[model samples]
Target: MLIPQYLFDAEAFLAFRIIEEKFHVISKSRISLLKLQLLHERALHRGHLKVAQQACDELGALASPVTGVDADLKTEVSLRHARTLLAANQFSQKSGNAALGLPYALASILFCQSFNLDLLKASATLTLAELWLSHGPSEAERALALLHGVFPMILGHGGLELCARAHITEAKCHLSDPSYSVHHKPDLVLSPLKEACEQLELLEYHELAAEAFYLMAMVYDKLGNLEEREKAAASFKEHTLALRNPQESVDDILNMI
Candidate 1:
């Protein structure tokens, strides 16, 4: 059955931003399912395991109550919560078995990319796709295709940064495959990486440019193209100081994914 992407997008969007304010109480009869994704991420980064676990527990509660006055809301919160759990590294599943949250996350992410079309959703989807790819080769091939297909979908709507990021993601996914090895060919992933760098340059997103350039250098190195590798490395260093605040950055956003 063809599910409604609009409804999914709105549901996921609300789940992602459920906590607009601490004082706001009651939301049309449903619980105020808060979004504390950032809190858990930040807590872990700061070595606050307790805080991170608390966030996880909060996610579980938010994800609970599959049947209630707000059924759709429950499903949406559960999906976001599952995505959060998958991202937190606090859960594990057997080999060759997809985690419970992953399939739901992937479905909503695709729905967002195919129909919802928003910058935040695009970024989130790409991040989840990367995670899916990291599971190994089979997932990598699927993710490579998905990233390529979604790139155009996001191009016009995801803003300059997100579009560039999508290209970079496509490039990285390509690099994950054996066909991308320089021994076989020097161009498998270079095109998109270069495109991403160029887009970043146009947008004056220098920090992101640095990362793209660095990855380009690695690809060139693998190709044994010392001159091109040197050039890319130089460019990467040139953009280093131009980066945004290290604490809050374009690169860091990619990491958050």
Candidate 2:
């Protein structure tokens, strides 16, 4: 289960083999659950979606027959499966498959709502909004409608990372809205994008932060503010490099300024 420390393919494969061997011999349900969780996470990290899905399916089967704390685990696992599918759909090469994650997102939202899991509900809502936004201008209004309540929901129960994503999604909806864009008001997106970038930086999610900065740079360029554009562009580059070399000190990035 010490897979995170040594994520090399060979090590991961060996660990998986060992885990599978132990799983068959293990009698404790909790121990088996932990092993499955580790396999699920490691497979997802390695982009082995089929393996992750199988792990998730096994987790559901293991958790479904239990109650009390295990019931909570079941719900959490369900949500996680939904999230993994959503991520896969979002990153898919087929833009035409934007609806791929919709059913899972909706199901997760319903599952969370039934349990009164407000935080997970909000998170699932955000995921649904993102999926809608991915449909381009045709679904922008629907995305905005969902986003209108998402910020307040995230603020109330969600953590900084979710809040950052909410801000970014809100900004994306505005950017994609024909009514908003046709007015030539690209600056309207800058505020939320800036908030997203700040929150992502604070969370040390440099890859996503870089994307937010790149969007801000584009907005600044649209506003004809070359200086602000350059600044945002520089930040984007710095964050991008930080993601590639995480061990590099802050001073290393600062020196590029």
Candidate 3:
């Protein structure tokens, strides 16, 4: 939502400090694990690998005994661990270790993200996507398809405006398949989809706008308009590349559909 970069950075830095202080006091507690996970996430974002690794080590130690922990805390730890792997470029193999917690982590991250936990949400979603991709093209495609439904809920649940927009963009990229159409009726009206898109756009979510446009293209394609479909495809390609480097764009993501 056109959030100031400085504001985000400042908030992240503050959170990291608080988390670090909290960890020193309760390093052996489950709550410390939670703080470590978050601190590690912030460290990763700031490209502080040493700190991130230290946080990850603490999180890993706590991962096993998280059963009796609060559901949300457990979810946060799992998500943070997965995210650390993603940041390290080890997402391909390591994400599988956190597979079981992927969905829950994604949900929790979405909630936290909605509330301005930028670093946490970004790390979690990026990892969740990577974990899904590690399962192979079929699973990746499935994850992308489900994103349309899953993301809207996250947005409704109080996800951050920018992160939610990024997610919608990712979802649109995944759903770019001309042949992948769903016919089942959703339990809720599809109005939230439009509403979320609008909110993102109002918030200067350019990346998200690009994604919403791409998703609209998919809908147009499903309606059998060749001209409109081509326009949507082209727009998707344009915006996707603009938001990130072309190499990072999911250029062939539509192939899965």
Reference-based TM-score of each model = 0.51, 0.70, 0.43
Against the true structure, candidate 2 reaches a TM-score of: 0.70
Candidate 3, 1-257: lDDT as tens digits:
35643245445556655766676764447445544544664454344445666665666566456444454455565565555554454323343444554665577575565566655555456456655654555665555654444454445554455344435535434443344443332112123335545665454334545656666666656666679668767766665564454221122211111
Residue lDDT tens for model 2, 100-137: 66776787677777778778778878888888888778
- Candidate 3 yields a Cα-based lDDT of 0.51
Off by over 4 Å in 1: 1-104, 110-124, 201-210, 237-257
Off by over 4 Å in 3: 1-38, 47-50, 60-67, 90-130, 134-137, 165-257
* Per-model root-mean-square deviation over C-alphas: 9.8, 8.6, 10.4
Error of 3 at 64 (Å): 9.0
lDDT of 2 at 46: 38
List clashing residue pairs in candidate 3.
1-203, 113-160, 114-158, 114-159, 114-160
lDDT score of residue 15 within candidate 1: 55
Better of 1 and 3 by lDDT: 1
Backbone clash count, each prediction separately: 0, 0, 5
Error of 1 at 21 (Å): 18
By lDDT, who's the top model here? 2
